[model samples]
Target: SLRINKGMHVDGNWPALGAAAAVAHSLGLTPAQTAQAVQIAACQLPMSLYLPVRSGDTSRNTYLGHSAQLGQSAALAVASGITSPGNAVREYAHVVLSKEPEPFDDTHGFHLLQAYVKPYAAVRHVHYGAWAACMLRPALDPDKIEHVILDVYEEAVIYCGNRAPQTPLQAQFSLSFGLAAMLGWGRLDPWVYREPQFQDAMLRALEAKVQVQVDASWTQQQMRGARLRIECSDGSRYEQEITAVPGDAQMPFTERELVDKFLGYCEASMPLDSARLWARQLLVAPTNTHPFPFWNLPQEKTPC
Candidate 1:
């Protein structure tokens, strides 16, 4: 009755339902119709696995993109009078997949407030170690570092245990490489997942030094934590243990920080002034008439 234990890809499994509900609501469907769309989406969802991720093949990346398409398709299907079983979600979960999906009462409020926005590009499991590595980076000399050890919760090891991962997506799921990226680049920016960083002498060297181990007690308690210990060639050791990463529900990023992150990304593709205007229009003004001001941003001219 445990889908995670059965190796379901949690990433793709959940987004489809959320997307379906979102689209259905945006289409001005009634509550009952939105429920129908979500139910239909759930019934058609795949029992995805981690094969592509494990093998460094990018095929699995399509699953989430397909999930978005599936969501829109399901909403459209409902609009076109496609009816789903009354208990399609529960039946498919308990009977077909032997899954016991968590029940949410939603009594108090929306769960969107509790959502986490990642400061780094890696999985949530990899963030703790990556953050710790970033902290120790300023103190350590990369060339003098002899080895690094990461003791993390059990599931972190299971889902993010890739050693010397060969591909960008594979590295995204790698605990060792994420930590190494932080140490080498002083931050685990999305760009570090590229082939050149993977081929970097310092990153490759540091990545090879990283050893991942399971902290059995933490796993038994189902705790999310990471402890990083770096052993230097000169016998100087640096260590840090983190119980929570930034941007988590308990330690959410401030509004200013979040806005800064948005500005940073937008500025990368456009002028700083344009990025500021876009942010102010979209986020500050709340103008419905000029929705998505990003479209009006400057575009480079095509070569004739």
Candidate 2:
């Protein structure tokens, strides 16, 4: 099967379609125009390969940024009177699957309700093992750790099986590496994916101890979860199971966490007060009826 892991890299492919749809909506395009925009995006969708991700190539990181830019351009092109063949999507769909296009069963309901916001820089599949390891961090000493076992759903293991990854992208996609990194650093934020962390002797030792297994129960339930067990040389064992990571609706981030996350990103470019003000304004922008704010960053050479 040409699935996400086998032949396709989903992150490289899906963003264009999403960006097209979102831009079309924001521009208030009619259904037909929106369809045209999507068709244009579909026709130009970049082909994806999983091999680069497996080898930790830097090109893999550029896929999403390029996809998003392509998407935005596709939507704007449509708004500027560009036209795309109406059947581009179904044609490629049939070609890709080598089967007739089947209707989507909308009975599964709206996709927005199923969305998960990410708290860490790693892939979603890596989160379960990482989260479980973090839960056990307080109890175990990194130096004395003898072996670690990560039992997770089959798909997670299949898609993200890298061990002792040496690069940022590889670490992001590696369940075993994520577990060790989280245990060593006590967190799985972007900073943990740096070169210093990659070269850390303790983290490397922890990665060597990890053994991943497939848990049939989680696979059958289609659940994103992991059971992590660590054995230390001191004749001690620690184990924990994480059924979900934060950002899942059932385990969502608190309001404070959300605000902090937003500010964290914003503060990199603007001052704290400006970021806070931008956060407030952006959070309430959807409810506000004023003309769409393009960009309201203060240009004044003084603090607000």
Candidate 3:
């Protein structure tokens, strides 16, 4: 799937569809009406193309407001306990599609590259890119090293550079920030995107030291990876190239690894036992045959 921007799910569009589905269940719309409500949400979605990394920008509003919220409103307007379905879809359609359309630009290709990495490409690349720099960090002495040279695919150069990232979202999207985070701190984890770590002055300085260059050969090959080469004042060099981003469909995490990953994410919020139970429930939810309102709904509402 060509999941542009933050993806239909990550940007809250899929949830909007789910919210609409919930309302559809309560109201018992005909299969045709239910289908229409879903189509309205899907068509009304303002595709996120060239979004600024800065979260404070008004452009970010489309991500939060357009698809998910509209879907929710459409479903509620037609539900039994809500307003009449009369003209509701039409009213919502006019409101939804009325916005000025987003433009097609160079950033659209970056979104495709991001989706190629899948699940968590932004996080994974930043994590490993930083790791590659960290591996070279120990070999260098400040007095002996010159600036670091980062060779990445064209998409990486476009997607990750030439920005001042003030928020986690910005940092998450930044390749320079990732390299700096790894070189300066030897790590780029979730916490690196948060508080004091993100704002570390030295890290910011290192970010400026990173020079990203596009490798046309890699771009031609349609590879999603990066190579970091460090040149010392003494003329020595260290280099590593990452050709396959982790979680890529071609080389996916094992089922057990995925479970462990789920447990890891859940452990942050819930007790280990509870996390395991939650993971199990989510894993098995699809196979469940009972007429539970949420799960029993047809899968037709799901975005492609």
> Which lDDT values do the candidates have, in the order given?
0.82, 0.80, 0.61
lDDT of 2 by residue, 1-304 (tens): 1234365687677578778878887888897888788889988777777778789898877889988887788888898899999887777666664655567455857879878887777889998888888788888788888988999999887778887787788888899888888898887776677667677888888888899999998889878789998888999989999898889989988777878877776655679987787677666757643432553444665211
- Candidate 1's C-alpha runs over 4 A off are 1-7, 263-268, 289-304
**Order of candidates by lDDT, top first?**
1, 2, 3
How many clashes in each candidate?
0, 0, 0
TM-score: the better of candidates 1 and 2: 1
Give all TM-scores, in the order shown. 0.85, 0.80, 0.58
Worst 10 residues of 3 by lDDT: 1-10
- Candidate 2 or 3, higher TM-score? 2
| Candidate 2 error regions (>4 Å) | 1-5, 72-90, 99-110, 263-281, 284-294, 297-304
Candidate with the larger lDDT of 1 and 3: 1
Model 3 CA lDDT for position 177: 86
**lDDT value for model 1:** 0.82
